[model samples]
Target chain A: MPDKSLRMRRAGGDGLVTRPVMLAIAGDSAAGKTTMTRGLVEALGPDRCVSLCTDDYHRYDREERKELPFTALHPDCNHLDIMEQHLQLLATGNPVLKPVYDHATGELVRPELVEPAEFVIVEGLFPLWSKLSRACFDVTVFLDPPEEIRRGWKVARDTSKRGYTQEKVLAELERREEESAAYIRPQRQNADLVVRFAPIEGRDDPAGTSLSASLMMRPTIDHPDLTDVLQSGLSRAMHLKLERDPDGRPVETLHVHGYVPREESLGVEKAIWSALGAPDTETPECLGRLGDARSEPLAIAQLLLLYHLTDAAR
Target chain B: MPDKSLRMRRAGGDGLVTRPVMLAIAGDSAAGKTTMTRGLVEALGPDRCVSLCTDDYHRYDREERKELPFTALHPDCNHLDIMEQHLQLLATGNPVLKPVYDHATGELVRPELVEPAEFVIVEGLFPLWSKLSRACFDVTVFLDPPEEIRRGWKVARDTSKRGYTQEKVLAELERREEESAAYIRPQRQNADLVVRFAPIEGRDDPAGTSLSASLMMRPTIDHPDLTDVLQSGLSRAMHLKLERDPDGRPVETLHVHGYVPREESLGVEKAIWSALGAPDTETPECLGRLGDARSEPLAIAQLLLLYHLTDAAR
Candidate 1:
């Protein structure tokens, strides 16, 4: 393609447009994609930000997928074309009559209308799967938590919330591994940022400590200058280092430690917020919320995303 | 407002597109819109053509409309934006997740996917109601039957098929008259072909005779050359005359007589089909069907629409 921003401006038809900035958070099931998206949406508030799950585009309900040979992770098992079309419409500041797949009932329910706002956060398995859909996003991030940790998250969430038994969740995870490898993992290479949240390897942390976050910031877009903030005596909470990406390319990676003191994390958060030149006096309190608990690593990661979204709007 | 054909070609990327031709048959309720659209879809075959009713975009079901202040004919009472968006998608040879309205139960049911074929026929109210929507059609037609004939057809159809009593139908018709004039009838000004089916005024024809058709073909698009065909001694069945259109503009009107003998109508049909340059030796037998009865005028009107559709495809 053509430059999507230019196409979007032309599609506006001479009207004044603060065209919505689109963000895609793509990952496999229970990879913390929703967790990453929810904080950003909450911080921006519902009026300015709207989020949707691409899982709603599933061609087969949970029961229907059982009859099919392939899992829902495969592109063929979902209406990816319609998802791409809806993304294009949303990116161009249009409304969509979106399909809704009810995970609880394993059935396709009545669709609802989704109106795009200033920030459209789309998270699911296939938002970044296609070039057309990927083109619609101003920034794309992929969640890549380790398989072991992701399996644990899936089992806990499914059993506690979705009413699935641990055995059934484990079996479904086992069945989905092949498709996840073939389809989901490959999308990480296309992301502007690859985020992995996990406990530090080889460092035994006390129980109840949140997982640290490692964000691999690719050179696809101009990232915020964190050198000054990192140099301002905030190294205990977060630091940046040059690392090799999965594709063997060198990238700047920011690692936020979850075991850091709350005051130190607050100092780093204030530094990043001020660097963003945001008009608000303080950072949004809604960031990094995991139910009732707050995760410092998630808060910093969401702050980084907020910087990119606001920068693109400019 | 930009060139839609060019946009559609660009949207197709490198893929070769025999882009589906679009035809719009817009009219008030019981004004023969479905009858006109059905014949064209049948003649083209399901594999080559698909049809959808815009009334499916109704924002309220029959039961819900009773609680509203205005009738369903109002633009606010329908998702015209979504309808327009779907039309744009279809015109570009894309599939739409279309909403379905259950007219019998007066309920909004689950939506279905609609894939465009070689020909896409869109009928019902509001297809020609907006400039953006009207732009998506290759050929636009408005059914303009006389008020008396339309009311009679609505009463007959609603009572026999839709389970509406004659008194209820008449009361609803009376209530809808203002909106029909305000929202529905005004679309006639936008259609390329204004078609009216009724008995010729001041002529005493048998009660069982088919209603004659008066087709006012505007100069908006290139019409088929019928000079040679009309001059070939087929005047007994149909004749072309210069007439002033509703807006007081000169237009070429073709009047097909319903009382014409079957042999005379067949001769006219064959001539028109040959004029269309179709390779088939005979016209489709599905044309002009009216519940086990055939109408010669209906067949000729449908043939005229077929000409426009195929011409646009070329």
Candidate 2:
């Protein structure tokens, strides 16, 4: 009945009401959004975290999209207004009857009720597409894999999991390129962190080497102190360097090497975990799970996000 | 983005934007809630008005309720919080993805998008159950037909249309009596108008005579000026008198006679319709329809509600 802010105030027992911390993971299709979200949610545990995808707000089913002139990347192809409204409700610690879009059937299915937990993680292509939606997030992230790498990942995923031919997935990717440039990529400017996972630009990696992660942390919110971790003799695993963003602004970027030994990356993870001051002494094993294997770089990236979520809850 | 009040202010074209006028028709099952809503929505036309039943907010399907201790009339049996939120949205001219309850199969089905027009008519069991819900309505009406008459109507309708046995309907009504008293009837105190349709007390009418309507207009809203219409030499069709309410408070009541000739009641209808100051000169033909039959009292009652809706929109 009352506005959310007032409701939050009234819910305080010691006159210190705290709303849920909201995180946004925005990226193009097959850009590892689900992988990033899965690790964070697993680390936080299901009781403390809830996740949803904005693709549920698609305006048309897969069959209906075949008749439209535009792909799903365009804002006009989705119910962005309703998505914004639902985001506001979730951010305010309210439950929403969230729409469900079934990827397997390519159909719009029955809606399910989603109650927000202490940490709300929203991942999809359009989480940061608008100002109102962007305002709903406390920490926003944009996944920025290289175009060639992302395309390869998409083809492999579509063929293996989604029952699509490599040619069809590639053609769909080609068709979505214009709208991705016009709508999706521009959202990178609004994110608090831009994360890119790829092989080093000028270096050749072994066939089985995992991809490294480059994280650009903007000064929009107070970030965790990583000065001690950088000097902990883990330079082969991670290092901080000054870089220029696309907007020609100077930013501090953290690079975590995937070629480093797992034990070396574990040292870096421990340093960041101690900086978090989390109640748990050991890092959660659920972090960095990619199917049956694990990636140390993903574990560290997720740990940094966990640090922010815990910091804001404070 | 913004709260409804702020959104309304920013929506102004001439700096006087008005939100949609909301009307709540609350009553027990088979108390003619749908009949009353049908007349009003038909009179206003589909382009300018939209109507939804709060029964759609039921938390359980009909099959599930058989196992629950309470009937659908209980507040706990419905998603009242979400219903309150949706009412707030519709009252502010915002669209909602409303849940659907299929009465035929007694199932909770897919949700449908509802965009409010100039007027929103909300009808069903618990629309007026809570103070917060009552506050969303510009005009509220509670239908209070006599118990015997309502039971008869329920039996006839359920048997003929819903494929229910008259014996089963009677048994169900008996089972629901306690909850109807505990949760439904008390909402009458919050309505702006309490309407009862039955034969006049201590009088015998012809075998086929229609039921008359007695409207108790509360002082919560400024009702239209009916002084001239009451004195327009139509006493046989309609008249106003002072009476004490169930709470022993003095109130003005309008009594419309169903036994009056059709031409005489039409004169009263014309008087009320003209008093609305509407641009249309002729009365709408769709009002007061009971399937293939019609009632003049139902027409006059609907016209009075239309007056309130138009007045609030101003």
Candidate 3:
């Protein structure tokens, strides 16, 4: 099949030009990608931002994957060609008939029509795997929580939402660890921002103390200036440090403190909201929700991505 | 009276030398100096940090100052010489019998013993006015809130706490403004950091949007690197902007946004907390309280000063 990007090319003299800012949030399963995407959609308003999960393009049902030698992290397990094509369509502000994989039932569902909005966020495992797919995005992010934290999240999610036993979830995670390492984790190198939310180091926090965040700001794109924010010294909960990434590249890491008072955290949020020039006077309530618990770092990461989207609009 | 610092100098002592990190928070009445100092004391722990209000050095009671030609902002209206001696003593880890000025009754009460801790935070109207006084501090901050905001705060504080009418408070502010401009405001020029907490520029927030803050990070002192915090793009609510101060000096200003989600502000606070090495998991609970409401910018300013205090210790 001809790549859909070719079909999406605007013909000369046609004068039908439409372009929406496209952002790709790529990560492994239960990496909080969808939750992060939801906050952006809410912050930008549903009417202006549209989101799609590329996991919907799974080649087989969940039970079918059991018979295969490889897990869903493998490219062969997903329809990367179609996902790339749809991403191309969305990038140019076009519509597509998209397939859906229902997570609860682990079954393929009927296709549905999807219209692109002013901002399009494509989030899933393989959105950044191919050069053609990567080209469709104006900005890209990779969620890279520690493996242990990710495992806890996945086990909880799979057990509660997908009806899998804790043992089954752990077994599956062990089974897919190699594929995830080979494929999904590599996407972090291509991301403009790599976000990791985890427990703060060297502190014995109370039971409800929020988890801290470490954001690796790669120099792949123009980022907002935060010297004023850091220098404002408004709250001790957040800070920035320079460090070397695993690939020996110089990267700036921003760590957000958790377990501070609620109002203090909001102070940082409003500053970010103002920076984005977003119309809202408050942060989206949909952010940071993991079941009943909330994550400050997750909300902040989403807000930064929202900044990129709204900034692109300007 | 024998100068405590002169006695502390020890012309020919063999050893027994120790020094305490001193921080000066100088500002006019109701500029939130005591509130700011409280947070730092809490963050560093009371055992390690001792705070004193320089207003305690008043040469005359409030009624006596009322009959005098000059207001409290005048150098002569305070025991500047004694304050200098005390500061010098505190700077080198010595104790002093500091006089107490009772704000409620407008009386010069009995003196109280003050022991020097690892960190000494001296806050009031004239802590940074003199060469000798300025030399006693390792770090200095000037709170320069807008006159309008200061007026409102003063009026509210005087009427409720000190038994003064709103009209009387306003008249007092006007009477003190000239002395404040000459004595208190000029101290801002010498400060390593100048903090201004007020409403965000050009935003009509609701009745309860926490006030925004601007901190001028002067290069006079070595400041923590905040490049990563700004680049992280986590909270658009906080940002660092380069701008010129009133004296035409180039300064980096950090602005913390208010009214954002609590989590967002915490993200910024956590980053700073992490930068400070996260010895304690929770932020100082006493921070961000401006009267009943909390100011994130105030907390951040305190935290930054805390960084300088601890950094000096190292």
Chain A: TM-score in each model: 0.92, 0.92, 0.90
| Local accuracy of candidate 3 as per-residue lDDT tens digits, B122-236 | 9999888876677777889999889888888888788999999988888888888899888888999999999988887775274777778888999988887776877787777
Candidate with the larger DockQ of 1 and 2: 1
Better TM-score candidate (1, 3):
1
lDDT of 1 by residue, A133-236 (tens): 78788899999999999999999999998889999999999999999999999999999999999876655274878899898999999988788878777566
Error at B252, model 2, angstroms? 2.2
The sequence of per-residue lDDT tens digits that candidate 3 reaches over residues A1-314 is 02111221221111244678889999999998877887788777889888899988887888899899999889998877567656755665556556678899988754455788888889999988976677777789999889998999999889988999999999999999999999999989999899888877874274667778888888777777676777787767777788999999988887886665567667667777787766476677777675588877777777778777777777
The DockQ of predicted model 3 stands at: 0.00
lDDT of 2 by residue, B182-287 (tens): 9999999888999999887644274677888888898888877776767867565678878989898777788877776778777777777777776368887888
Question: lDDT values of the candidates?
Answer: 0.84, 0.82, 0.77
- The per-model DockQ list reads 0.35, 0.29, 0.00
Model 3 alpha-carbon drift over 4 Å, by segment: A1-314, B1-15, B203-207, B278-282
Candidate 1 wrong stretches, greater than 4 Å: A1-16, A204-206, A231-237, B1-16, B163-167, B227-237
The sequence of per-residue lDDT tens digits that candidate 2 reaches over residues A134-174 is: 77878999999999999998998989988888999999999
Residue A292 displacement (Å), model 1: 1.1
lDDT of 3 at A76: 92
Best by DockQ: 1
Question: Residue A152 error for model 2, in Å?
Answer: 3.6
- Give the per-prediction TM-score of chain B: 0.92, 0.91, 0.91
Clash counts for the predictions, in order: 0, 0, 48
